[model samples]
Target: MSRVTVQLNGRDFTIGCEEGQEAYLRELAGSLDKRVSEISGQVGQIGDLRLLLMASLILVDDLKESDRKIAELEGQAQRLRHENHGAASLQAEARNELTAHLTRLAERMESFADTLEAAGDDSDGDGGVPAPDTSLAEAGA
Candidate 1:
């Protein structure tokens, strides 16, 4: 065990802790002393017990408030996560719809291209224009 001297409300006292925990104990004492000092400033020179009680109450109130804030923030985080999942689902649905539409459009374009190619095959090579009949030319001659 290690002994540490701490001051609270202008009085010095010795406290004991494990060797490695001396610093942590000192830190806790410092926090208590600071709270007591604040209480003293507000309500001057109250007895030691009353001062310590008021400081402890204040610290407990602060701890409760911090816990409440943490819970509120956690709720917000969960709600945001749910919203993000919904948005991602919606985006995936939209992409699928767009992809299906594009595939149908591509099929229609390919059918049109096949029809044009068949028409071209049925005519002369002059861009689907028929050739002049040789019998008609001979008759004219």
Candidate 2:
């Protein structure tokens, strides 16, 4: 551990941090001191305890605002995920419906083939020249 002395409101305080984290700790301390000085200057003749309490309140408010922003972003992400899920489900349902409709069309084409075959047979019995059944699909032909 390493110790750093930080002066806030004209008082020196020592805080501990890991050796490599000195720069970050120092920067954090500097920022806090700046905030305290800014506040103390506006509210002159403030007690040390009251000054610290006010600083704590300011820091806590900042933390809370950061947390609130994070929560809002998380909610946005979840809503987007929900919308994507709904769209995917709708696409799947559409594909299934299209498949069913195509199958029905194929069945109707097969029924038409049977009717044409019967009509050809009837025409032959009546001694009429049978017109060609040119409408047969390649697969059925």
Candidate 3:
């Protein structure tokens, strides 16, 4: 345990805290003293208890406001996260759909190529008619 002497309203008070928290305690005391002094100035040196009470209330109000803001920010963050997750899912679904479409188109093109190849083979060997002359231009020249 550690003891720290803090001056508030021109009075020194001893406070006890954990060993490593002496500095933190002193800092808190300093802030409280400043608040009390401000209140005293406004209210003209009212009783120490009343000044302290008013300061405590003000501090509590500030803390509550801060808590509310933090909660609001956290809610916004959660909503944004949900929206991003939905967007990512939509993108993945679109990618999958595109992949399936491309696969089908490739299969169709392969079938068309096979059909054309079969027709060419038939013209060359399976039919009784002679193949069309591809070298007619050269022969004339």
Residue 62 C-alpha lDDT in model 2 = 96
Clashes of 2: 0
lDDT of 2: 0.84
Task: Point out where model 1 deviates above 4 Å.
Answer: 124-141
Q: Estimate each model's TM-score.
A: 0.81, 0.73, 0.83
Off by over 4 Å in 3: 125-141
Q: For residues 106-135, could you state the per-residue lDDT of candidate 3 as single tens digits? A: 899778656655655678575764544547
Arranged by TM-score, best first = 3, 1, 2
Cα shift from native, residue 7, model 2 (Å): 3.1
Best by TM-score: 3
Question: Candidate 2, residue 109: CA error in Å?
Answer: 2.3
Give the per-residue lDDT digits (tens) of candidate 1, residues 13-97: 9988888997888899999999999889999988999999999999999999999999999999999999999999999999999
Compared to the true structure, candidate 2 yields what TM-score? 0.73
Positional deviation of 133 in candidate 1, in angstroms? 24
lDDT of 3: 0.85
Error of 2 at 85 (Å): 2.1
What's the lDDT for residue 104 in model 3? 100
